[model samples]
Target: MCWDDGMVDPAPTDTGRAPADEPAARPAVRIAVAQRVPPRYGDPPALRRLATAATDANGADLLLVPELYPAGFRLDTDELAELAESRESFAAHLGAVARTHRIAIVAGYPERGPDDTVYSSAIFVDADGTELAHYRKLHLFGDETAAFGRGHQVPPVCRWRGWGVGLALCYDIEFPELARLLADRGADLICVPAGNMVGYSEVPEVLVPARACENQVFVAYANYCNSDDEFDYDGHSVVASPYGSLLAEAGQDEPQVLMVDLDPGLQAAARAHNTHRNDRRHDVYRGPDPTIG
Candidate 1:
């Protein structure tokens, strides 16, 4: 894991809220998050097998892979160009996996875009081999600025079985506004795919639950684990509930696929305790004209 003195480990400040009982009748979805995956050059068949086993073994309804799952996170243009996946092929392959496993899957890859750009992108493949939602990383991080182009728009919240799910990359969720925007749009859950390294492991432990609580939504953050030649990852994948509780977490250096339930009625019950979503004084804070909004 890479450590830098420039970045401090994040700590959640809102910790003392009174607890509320979650609704018992809420319908729940079984979700899973991956902590490690094959690198850029890994065999395609192997990747599919790993994903299949993950969903089948846990009977997970939805499975999320780390950011840039197929094409490694740190490769430069030349290497990435050779490894870049066309959106069509990426979708078709993952869609097939989803169909065979009867599990919805979220996978990330380096997508070749217009004008020779490659965007760090992801897609949600439904259980029936259909594409549900797609998103490009809106916020770029570290070496990503030079490796890929930035995305221009926010992805639409996906309607899954009855849950409204929002997607974001690693760094995007760190900025509260992104998750808040999704919550304001009626998102019941937010999914984050990350390439988190050491020293910055605090995100899943601290920031993820904070995002969930502040937005009154559930958050599943999946991260890459272990170290490669260029980087060492923190490997702590976690799922946080709207009540800021860490539902499940992986080890610092181990790879894991965690299965947890996200209950909408429970999220709504949590939101009942959290009225800030509608109570925020936006008039004083609407900084840029939403023409840019």
Candidate 2:
């Protein structure tokens, strides 16, 4: 149901009950990544500093930060209850910063959903501080399954700077199907807010670029850069191109901001050259036996 017959896949439409605004794009955009001081449990101030640090320096058109640093990404349900922010509150706060900085921002927080559910969430605010996409993480990592509720909606694709942009987070980007789905649905950029742990070089080094190369889309991974009780986070965050070449990368263990210029024309050329998606043999591919099903 997600795919159709075509030499090129069609643009994706929002399928969930949640509302989505019309997508807008630009020819080129500048993206900035932040590796900042990890937040402590129940600290919104720390979260604010992280946001400011991302934009307070040599800012760009868009800013990306790691997942739920407000709770240090290791909170128990009780801790999360204290740290999670209401949507309205978060919007009011981040929107002001985005508008003042004149930079679109994508940052993570633990959202306090109705019924006391806590969802690891990412909020996207435009340069004018208009909230664009508010997405919850779909793939929960290890202990996070016990700590957080999973988001139901598929990652929606929005247009930014004349290119298709998809929303995803940490473990979500580790899955091939998710990225492929985004790409097949005409996503030119995949922005991830991740809290990737130490020692998984394959993820940032292999899977990230692999997704970009195979899908012919730009992938930006923003991660935390410290060791805490919950994670020994290694911050080798990067922006990879459609051709799988890295545009920018951060230090392995420091607080830094990595910036790069992204051109949609390059993505267009890569998609034209990479036939992986176009060459799929759907008829030859099948799922498990009905008995197993």
Candidate 3:
């Protein structure tokens, strides 16, 4: 059942199943996280740079980029509206990039929704240029509240290249409920496109891995490394395993791309030993009865 009424449960097609001839020991997926600052708002170079990054991630199955990578981060409401593009335009551009490079992508963009409202949004394009999912950032942080509309839909889990891939934005990753919801919906990997600042190093260092361990899913966080007009990003892009281990991490201030292989076996093993999801006491997790207190 959907926990939120606004959430549309995406029908997950079994596109990720391994064939009988495939070897069991083979890694399920290879992902690349690009931790670089894009061109400033309204700069045409930003779109070109994303395509270039896709080429850089040549052999990987998927590429995860930072939040608002098309437009510069730290925009006011006016700039956000001005910079936001229709989801179709963004998707088409991303599709071309993905098709050219033969790599699935989860990249952020400022979406110009109906009625000209803007949102901090991300889209997932399959390697074959099919648009799989679109997720607007749900939990806004700081200036984001004034800049964009809150997303009303829960993130969807899509089957892609032998994995159940899910999407979330920077601040959204910090909230345990969202990640748990994704896990419960059968997400094997949660990809976060973030714009975390210098003061929040622990998010990538501590919280991300914790989320992965708790849910028995791989979590990949891609963040900007350089400073924008208003914020200096921390740039510790990382990939965490189901075992809560750091598979890869980028540096604090340098542009980097981290590549890691995700083994489905790890998730199976983690679930075998740590059945946290199964151990939850849902009946006791409700709010206090208003009649009693």
In TM-score terms, which candidate is top?
Answer: 3
For residues 137-207, write the lDDT of model 2, one tens digit per residue: 88987788898999877676665665667888988888999998787565778889888888886788888
Kindly provide the TM-score of model 2 when superposed on the true structure, using C-alpha atoms.
0.86
RMSD of each: 8.7, 5.5, 4.4
**Which ranges in model 1 have alpha carbons more than 4 Å from their true place?**
1-26, 37-46, 49-57, 287-293
Residue 40 of model 1, lDDT score: 42
RMSD of candidate 1 to the truth, in angstroms, is 8.7
For each candidate, what is the lDDT?
0.76, 0.76, 0.83
Per-residue lDDT of model 3, residues 182-215, tens digit only: 8777677899999899898999999999999998
Positional deviation of residue 135's Cα in model 2 after best superposition, in angstroms: 1.1
Model 1 has a clash total of 1
TM values, all candidates: 0.85, 0.86, 0.89
Task: Give the poorly placed runs of model 2, Cα more than 4 Å off.
Answer: 1-26, 42-44, 286-293
Query: Which one wins on lDDT?
Result: 3
